[model samples]
Target: MSRFAEVLGRLAATIEARKGADASTSYTAQLLAEPARAAKKLGEEAVETVIAAAQGDKAGVASESADLIYHWLVALAACGVSLDEVAAKLEAREGTSGLAEKAARKT
Candidate 1:
């Protein structure tokens, strides 16, 4: 498995651990304790990632991608989703045509 995939597992574990964590010691705990603020921060980081891509800044893209990943894990914590499921869905789609996939979704 890719190390990046491991990140998703780590993210899940971190969020789970955060549930009972001391806010002073765990940033994940702090984020889990907030909702709207956390969403706003995630949005900001997503925009930063987009801006970095648009600006052709590789380093900026790398930094913002990390931020995006972090906030995504936080948001997933809020929503109670599993990375494994997402990866499975992606794997299922691997051989499908993009156009066919979009058309299939509309039916």
Candidate 2:
């Protein structure tokens, strides 16, 4: 795997470990304590990312996108969803048209 992928995997593992940690000390634990809060944070980050992209701020978009992915990973961890599960779903969609995928989901 690439170094970036390895780092992301390690970060996900660390976040998962922090899920049960003391909320007073761990930000991940604090997020895990409240699902709605985590979801809200993810949404906010996503909006920031979009705004950065729209404003043509490459650096801002990268920074906000990082925040967005972190929150998304946190939300997934908080909900007991593993990255492997997500990867499997993506793998299953390989070679499929994006429109077809959306149509299949609606069925």
Candidate 3:
């Protein structure tokens, strides 16, 4: 696996481990305790990422995108979905045209 993928996998495991942690001490646990809150955080991070991208700030975009992905992963965990499952879906889409994938999803 690529180093990036390895980092994400490790982060996922760390997040998963925090599911049962004390909310007062663990931000991940707090997020997991209220999935809606986690979703909201993901949305906020996405906006920041978009703003960074629109402003042509490479560093800002990179940082905000990392934040976005982190929040998104937390949201997924809050929803009881694993990163492996997400990876599987992505893998299943490999080689398919983006338009074809969209069309297939609509059915």
Candidate 4:
């Protein structure tokens, strides 16, 4: 596996393991326990990442992107969605024009 995949796999595994943990001790558990809260956090992180990128703060962008990914994974986990499900969606988009894909969504 690529390093990126390995890292994400490990992070996803850790989040899964934390699902049954005490929320007071594990932030991941807290996020997993509250899907709405996890979704809100994901939104917040996404905005931060966008702001960092807009400001041309490379380091800030990287840091905020990591936060964004973590919160996104947590939100997906909380909603009982798996990485494979997300991957399938991406795979389906392969070779499709972005504009065409988006236009199809509107129908």
Q: Please tell me which predicted candidate would have the highest lDDT against the true structure.
A: 4
Clashing pairs in 3: none
Full ranking by TM-score: 4, 2, 3, 1
Instruction: Please give, for residues 3-75, the per-residue lDDT of candidate 4 as tens digits.
Output: 9899999999989889889999999999999999999999999999999999999999999999999999999
Cα lDDT of model 3 by residue, 30-100, tens digit? 99999999999999999999999999999999999889888898999999998779889999999999999
lDDT of 2 at 18: 90
**Candidate 4, which segments miss by more than 4 Å at Cα?**
none
lDDT scores of the candidates, listed in order: 0.84, 0.92, 0.93, 0.96
Give the C-alpha miss distance for residue 26 in model 1, angstroms: 3.0
Candidate 1 TM-score versus the reference: 0.82
* Local accuracy of candidate 1 as per-residue lDDT tens digits, 1-107: 99987876777787887886898997788777786666878999999999999999999999999999889878767666667677898998899999998899999
Error of 1 at 103 (Å): 1.8
What are the models' TM-scores?
0.82, 0.94, 0.93, 0.97
Query: Which prediction has more favorable TM-score, 1 or 4?
Result: 4
Per-prediction tally of clashes: 0, 0, 0, 0
Poorest 10 consecutive residues of model 2 by lDDT?
11-20
